[model samples]
Target chain A: MKTCYNCNRLNKDNDRYCRYCGKAIRNNSYYTGLKIGIVLGTLGIIIMLILYAIMYL
Target chain B: MKCIKCGAELEDVDNFCPECGELTAKGHRFFHDPSNLDILNNGKAVKLKKKFNAIISIFSLSVIIFALLMIFTGQNLMTPFGVIQKKINYYRYGYNTSLIKTNNKYNFKVNNYDEAIEFIKKDFSNQLYTCNQNKELTMLEYELESDYEIPSVVFCDMSLEEAHKIKDVIVRMYALFPNIKGNLTNITITNSKTGSDYVAYFQPAYQFVNVNKDIKENNKVNKTQILLNSYYFLNDNILSQDINEVLNNYYVEDATFESTIAHELGHYISFVAFLREKGVSNITLVTKDNEEEIKSLINEFENGEYLKNILEQALNNYNLKYNENLNLQSFAETISKYAGVKDKNGNLLYSETIAEAIHDYYLHNENAKKSSYEIVMVLKSKLKEVF
Candidate 1:
C-alpha cells in the first residue's frame, strides 16, 4: 500500500498521496540531476580518450 | 502544536497562520502528544494511516527479507542496499571474518590475499612450490585480493607457433574462470639479458588448495605459481611423447592431460593452503633461516623417501586384513617402490597402503583438515631415518 501525503500514515503503494497527511510519495529526487551530470561527464571523457588514442595511433 | 509564524495554537488556518505567515515543514503542524492515533485515525484517518503504515512496514520488511536471502544464498547483498546501508556494507565468511565481495571469481577471506600473494612469491623464489610436488611448506605468505583474473604464464622457451597444441590445452582450462585472459608469452631469461625461450606469466593470483589426481602410471605434472608467472609447458616433443606413453602404460585412455592438470595443480595448492592455514611466516627468502646443516637434514625428509618406508610397512603388515582382492605373492615385489613406497617388505605395505588411504581420505573424507603438529613433528620425526 502507498503512504498518505498529509500524515506519516500507511497507504497503498499505488496511491499517489500519503495515507495520513497527504504528501508526495515519490522518493526525494535528491540525486537524479547529479547522477545525470556525472553520466554526461563520463561519456565526454570516454569520447575524448577514444579520439586521443585514435590520433596518437 | 502551535504555528510558529502566527503564534497561535494550530486551529482553522491555512498551512501558514492567519495572524502571521510562515511556511511549515511537511506535516509538522499535525504533530500532537501521542495518545491513540492509529485506532482513532482508522475511522478518522484509520484507513489512511493503515495504508501509510503498510508502506513503511513493507520497506522495513523488504530489508529484512533481502537480508535473509543474502544469508541463505551466500551472496553479498550489501551493494544493493540504500546509500547509508551501502556505505556500511559488510559480508562474513571463513571463521567469522567480515569480507567485502567483489565481482571476481577469486573469492576468498579478506585476510587471505596477503597470505596468498606472499606464498606465491615464495614459490617463485624458492622453486619449491609446484602444482604437483608433495612438499612440506616450511613457510608461506599470501596476498589474497579478489582478483578473479586468471594469470598468464610466459613461455620464453617456445612460441605459440611452436607450442600451438599445448597453448590450446592451457588456455582452454583457463577459460573455465570468467576473468582469465591473455595468451601465453615466452619470456625465459637465463641471464639478465638472455631470457629463456619457454616462459609465460599470469596475473591476479588465486589459491588452489590441492589438485588431487592419480599419479601412478600417469606422470604427475606439477606446476608452481598457477596464480601468476603463468605456467609454460616446455616443448620437448620427444620427452612429451615419452611422458604420454609412460602415462598410457599405467592407466586407461580416460586419464588424459585434461585430467592430469587438475591433479598436479592440487598438490601445490594444498601445500599453499596448508602453510596459510597454519599461519606460517618469514617466507621471503628460500634458503634456510637456521643452520645450513640443519636445513639440509630437514630437506631430506621433504624428498618423501623415509615416510614412504613407514607407510609401506603399515600396509604390508595389515594388507591381508585391509583388503582381500589382491594376490599375495604378486604383492611382495611390485611397482609400489617407485610410487613412494620404501624397499622393506613391510615398508611397501604401509606406504602404498597409506597413499591409498590418504588419497581416499583427501578425496572422499568429509573433513580434510590437517594437524600441522603431526606433520611437523610426528610425521617429520618418523621420516628422519630416510633423510
Candidate 2:
C-alpha cells in the first residue's frame, strides 16, 4: 500500500497514481529520477567549484 | 633613320648614314618599322596618341579612386616602421630597430638559468589546471583551448639549453621595462593549444589567486604571470640566434619567441596601466587592509565601467575613422585578424585587441596600426603617464 501526499489517500502499492486524488505515488521510477537529479546536481556543483578554484587558486 | 650631323646614303632601317653621314628625312622615324608607314599615312598615329592618352587617363582615375578608398578605409600610406623611421631617423644608424633587443642588459631577479627553473617550479605547478585537451604535442603536447575562465597552465620539461633561451628572453623582457621590477613573474612554458587565443598571454594577479579571502597569511604581492607555448622553442621554428632579429623580424607563418613574449608583456603593461588608472598603488601588496577594496576593484575593472569605457572610446574612434557603423567585434576584426578573439557572448575581447595593437606598434606593422591608431594612442598615453 502507498499513500498519496497530495490527497492523503491510500492506494495499492503497484498503482502509479492515487485512485481518489489522481496524484502520483512515489515509485521506483520516481526514486530513480530523484537519484539522477541529485547526482547531476551534485556533479554540476562540483564542476563549478573546481572551475572556481582553478580560476582563483 | 640617319644622323643629323653626318648622314650620306641611309637605309630605311638605319639610324646613321652609311656613307657621308648626312641627315635623311626617312630617318625621322628612328626605330619604327618601314612597313608601319601605312598606319602613319592613314592618320592612325594621332589616333594612337589619343588611345594612349585615354589609357593614361583611365589609369590615373583608377589610381585616384584606389587612393580615396584606402584613405576612407583607414589604410595609411605610412606603416608604423615608416612613421618611426621618419621620427627617429632610424634608417641612418643601420642598427637593429627592435626596442627591446637594443636596450636589453641581461638583468634578472633570478641569478642563473637553473635558478629561474627552480623559481618557476616553486611558484607554479606542473599540473595543467584548465588545459583539458589530449592532443599529442610535438615536443610537449598541449590540448586545452579554454578562454580566461580557467587558468590554462602548461608545465613543459625544459632542457638546460631551452631554459637558457627562456632565461635570455626573460632578461631582455625585464630590461625592456625596468619600472616593472616586481610586476612580471611566474613565466611557465606551456604547450596549451591556442585556437582563438594568442599563443602567449599575460594573466593578471586576481586570476592566479583568490583575492576575496581574509588576508591573514597570503599577503604576498602577486604579479602577472606570463604563459608561453613551447612550440616557439622548437628547433625548426627558430628564426635566428640573435634576439634582436627574433624581436624585430615579422614572419608570415610562425610567431617568433621574442615577439610573442613582447606581446604578452604588452598585456602586462596595459593591465598595469589600468591598475594605475583606477588609483591602485604598490600593486604587489595584498594586505587585509585593502583586500576587499582590491577584490571589488578587480571585479569592476574586469566586468564593470572601466572596461566599458575603453571599448566605447575605441569603437567610437574606429567607426568615425572608417565611416561605418560597426560593433566591437567587427571593429576588432577590422583592426587586425588576431585582435578579433571573441568573448563568451561573441563580443570581441578589448584587451586582446589592445595587446595586438601594442604588438603592431612594437613591430611597426603599418596596416594594423592605421586602423588601430586610436587604441595605440591610448596605449602610448598609458605607457607614458602610468609607467
Candidate 3:
C-alpha cells in the first residue's frame, strides 16, 4: 500500500492515485527501510555490548 | 474533519469537500502510525510487513543463539580476536589462588618457564615408592573439586608440592592441547599409593557421547566432537618412579605422568576423530537416534583394520631397521604394555596403539618415535586434519 502525502490516506499498491483523496500515492518503502535500519542498529549495539563483556569482564 | 484549503465540515466517508470540492482526509489517522494503514492491494502491504518482521526476528534470534553458543562452549566462534583471547585464557588457567599458595609454600625460586618446569620436576623426582614397588599400599580417594561443573582433582593427602606438580601438568597439558581442555574431566588423583597398576586411565563415557542436550538446545548442525564426562584417574605414585623406571615398565621412554595424561587425552581425541571420519557429525546427535548404529561403528573403528594396518606397517618398519623378529603382539608390547591390550574378542584395541604413539610424540620419546615413526606421524596428521 502507498500513502498519499497530501491527504494521508492509504491507497492500493498498483494505483498511482489515491482511491479516496485522488492524490498521487508515492511508494513508502523508504519508511520500511528506516524501520529495518532501526531494528538492526539496535541489534548491533546489543551484540557489541555482549562482546565487550566476554572479552574484558 | 475539516479541509485544509477551506473551512468546510466533511463527513468521515466523504472523499471531497462539499463547498470547495477540495480533497478530504477520508478519516485517515496519522501517516507515521503503521497501525493506521488500511489493508489495501489484497493485503500485500501486510504481507510485506510480515516479511520485514520475520527477517528482523530471524536475524535477532540468530545473533542471540550465536552468543549463547560462544558463552557455553567458551569459544569465540573464530572471530578475528578469538585466537588472541584463547592465548590469553591458555596462560590464565594455572594462575589461580591454589597455584599461588603452592609457589609460596615451596619457594620455587622460579624465574622462567624452564625454571618452573625444573621446580616441578624436582617436586616429582626421587620420591617415596616406585610404581612397581608399591605393594599393599592404601588407596585413599580424594574429594573432587568442580570447575564449570566438571569434576576436577583435589589433592587431599598430597604435599602442596606434589599437588602443584600435577597442577603444572594440567596447566601444561591445556597449554599444549587447548581442545582437550573441558573434555578431560573427573580427574581423581589417588593419594600417594599405587593402588592400581596403571599410571592413569581414561574411562570413556560412551553414554555421555550420545546425550545431546547441548547440541539439541543450541541446534548446532556442524560436525563437531564432544567427549563429555570422561573419567581420568591419576595414581600419584607414578610420579615417585624415576623416568627410567617409567620407561622400563611402560616401554615408552621418558613417559612421565604428564605423558600418561596426554595418552588418556589422546584416547578422547582419537575417538572423536574416528567418529568424524566415519561420517558421524556430532557424537551426541548420532547416538541420540542411531544408538545401535553408533555403537557398531565405534566397535568397528576400535577393532578396525585402519589402525591395524598402521601398526603392522610400523612394526614392519621397526623390524626392518633393528633386524628384530617381532610380530604385532610383541611389537605392541614393545611400544607399551597398554598398546598390546586386547578386547573381549581378543582383537587388538588399536586405540591404545594410537594413544601410545601420541604419548611418545607428546614426550618427544626418541626411541619410541624412531621405532614407531609411522604410527606417530599418522596420529600427528590425524590431529592436524581434524583440529
Better structure of 1 and 2 per lDDT: 2
| Ranking of candidates on TM-score, top first | 2, 3, 1
- Cα error, residue B231 of model 1, in Å, equals 13
C-alpha RMSD over true interface residues, each candidate = 15.7, 48.0, 8.7
Compared to the true structure, candidate 3 yields what TM-score?
0.40
Off by over 4 Å in 2: A1-57, B1-182, B190-198, B206-214, B217-221, B231-257, B318-326, B365-367
Q: Candidate 2: TM-score? A: 0.42
Candidate 3 recovers what fraction of true contacts? Answer: 0.05
DockQ of 2: 0.00
Q: Which candidate, 1 or 2, has the higher TM-score?
A: 2
Residue pairs with clashing backbones, model 3: none
Best by lDDT: 3
Backbone N/Cα/C clashes per model: 95, 10, 0
CA-RMSD of model 1? 21.9
